[model samples]
Target: MPYVNIKVTDESVNAEQKRQLIEGATHLLVTVLNKDPATTHVVIDLVPTDNWGVSGKSVTRLRQQQVKEAIQAQAERRAQEQ
Candidate 1:
């Protein structure tokens, strides 16, 4: 039996997307390793942004920084247009 674990941030992932991910993972194992779908196990884990970090910063912080930068850029653009 082949076991696959997928981890993603606790973002807006709908049920259909989860279903597709499971299906795609199963298909990949079947095609690449010739694993039996019936015996293949796929698990998805969602981690909170605060628990997930990159480059010494949490995902929540990174996302906040991104939004701040976007807003600043937009303001600059408006100032230039005026």
Candidate 2:
């Protein structure tokens, strides 16, 4: 039996997408490793943004920083065009 675990942020993933993921994972293992589809297991874990970290900052904070930077860049561009 083959097992696959997929982790993603809790960003409202619907049922159809989850189904596709499971099917795709199963197909990949079957195609690449010659594993049996019936015996393959695929699990998806949804983690909160605050729980996932990168470069010593949580994803939530990183996303906030990205938005702030985008707004600043837009303001700078508009100022230059005027």
Candidate 3:
């Protein structure tokens, strides 16, 4: 089982966003996390932006640098804020 608590912005969350996170996390459990889809469990929880950081920078201090670029891109395209 894999439990993933994703800290994201309240300004950047939605139902489809939640679904995408869950799906993506589940995929990770099966792929990167090395869990078998048939026997694994996955859970997702959304936290406020205050709880997330990127490359040593807190969400509030976001600088839009390369390190946060992919993650930010994912959020924009997937409706998520991870």
Candidate 4:
């Protein structure tokens, strides 16, 4: 069995979101990784926003904005490294 863990801010996910996440993530693994969805275990969590900080400030204040900036920065950094 394969297990996947997802971490995200609490405001972005709820019980219904968790269900969708598990199903969708499982689908991705099945299609891309050639893993059996039936045997894959997916765990979704709502991490405290404080755990993710951005731009000299706490993510607790600007969750969505910080997440967007973080993603963009990550992509930029990867592009630079490549």
C-alpha lDDT of all candidate models, in order = 0.97, 0.97, 0.69, 0.83
TM-scores, one per candidate = 0.96, 0.92, 0.46, 0.64
Off by over 4 Å in 2: none
lDDT by residue (7-78, candidate 2, tens digit) is: 999878999999999999999999999999999999999999999998999999999999999999999999
User: Can you list the residue pairs that collide in candidate 3?
Assistant: none
Q: How far is candidate 2 from the true structure (C-alpha RMSD, Å)?
A: 1.0
lDDT by residue for model 4 over 12-74, one digit each (tens)?
Answer: 576787889899999989888899878999987777878776677667868667688999999
Which regions of candidate 4 fall more than 4 Å away from where they truly are? 63-82
Total residue pair clashes for candidate 3: 0
lDDT (tens digit, per residue) of candidate 1 on 4-41: 99999999988999999999999999999999999999
lDDT of 3 by residue, 1-82 (tens): 6666675565567789788877887888888868877665555556555677767776665744555887878779887544
Q: Lowest lDDT 10-mer window, candidate 2?
A: 8-17
- Tell me the spans in candidate 3 whose CA falls farther than 4 Å from its real position: 38-44, 48-82
Candidate 4 lDDT score at position 6: 94
Compute the lDDT of residue 74 as modeled in candidate 3.
Answer: 78
How do all the candidates rank in terms of TM-score, highest first? 1, 2, 4, 3
Error of 3 at 22 (Å): 0.3
